[model samples]
Target: MGCATPWCLATLVAIALALRSGYAVSGLVLVSGYYFPTARTDFWLTSAPAMPLLGDLMRYTSPPIISWAIMPKLMRTLFAPRAIPPEFKNEFPISLALRPKQLRAAAEESAFLIPAAAQLRLQYRVSGVQLGSCMERLTGSSRPTSRRLHAVLPSSLLHLVEDAGHMVTYADAAGIADAVAALAPSAPVRTA
Candidate 1:
């Protein structure tokens, strides 16, 4: 879970920067599970309107979306970390959503991460898949509202697995595995 974010960020950032710097990008296959492409601080808040006011307030600290503003309590919450049970770590989005500590960790990461990612996406605009397409095609699955991936990723590589939810690891592990297998080369990395 933790490794994926850094890996993708590093890969995307490196590729984008390399492209800008005239570095060669070879055999790149970007497979994003569910990416919030926009760098606006409000991107996540706007994505989930039903989220509590705290979520919106927390996100408001980011740039371009700082217009959402913040409160003194929000500031305290942002700096303070509440204790979360170890069990929550295994849960899905709930673990991330309901817990203040987890949210703080995520907020801290995203505060800087999202803006940088937004710059990369905005500047390079690499084409990739919108992971939500998987659920949108189904009759009783989730709503088909997430088309943001198209903004950053190319439509050619974009694939949406049926019924895949936010927790793609558990919801459609096989499908993700297949996509990675097909997109990623089997050869081992070469070291100097």
Candidate 2:
């Protein structure tokens, strides 16, 4: 265990030197103090003292190890912005449809239904359910369009909608099972 400290230090020094010299290093190193060969008695006695010195040097270079090591790469990736294509932007005419009150009501109603739909796998049965609320909140008219989409969805899909809030009532569960059974192909007839 104590030996691993020196070995780890040596490894970090090598990495720092290599990185400074424009070299690359990869793969993992394992160091154990207690298991297999003991670090102090086995590795230290067998290896050069300079190895531990390098490890110590590496340790002194930084306090927050993650900040010194990995954060730069992550920060670079995250802060770099990208542009969205024009074709992907919203063009659904949400501004012309719903009033503020209707939009708010639809948003609340959809919020209640979205989780239930997810829990019951209702999305697999129904298509065009807009689980997004941001647009409705921003435009204050998109809620009616969202509700219309939900309301006009086929009975096959609507059968999964539970009256008892997000929970699937016993009746709803039975109805879903029946609907699934009706849609499932009949087993081929068997003749003996």
Candidate with maximal lDDT: 1
lDDT of 2 at 146: 21
> lDDT values of the candidates?
0.40, 0.29
Candidate 2 clashes between residue pairs 3 or more apart in a chain or in different chains: 1-33, 9-55, 10-55
Quality of model 1 by C-alpha lDDT: 0.40
lDDT of 1 by residue, 44-82 (tens): 543332245855555444422332244334423322232
Off by over 4 Å in 1: 1-103, 126-146, 151-155, 185-192
* TM-score of every candidate relative to the true structure: 0.41, 0.19
Q: Candidate 2 — worst ten consecutive residues by lDDT sum?
A: 133-142
- Judged by whole-model lDDT over C-alpha atoms, candidate 2 comes out at 0.29
For residue 144, model 1's alpha carbon misses the true position, in angstroms, by 6.5
Highest TM-score model number: 1
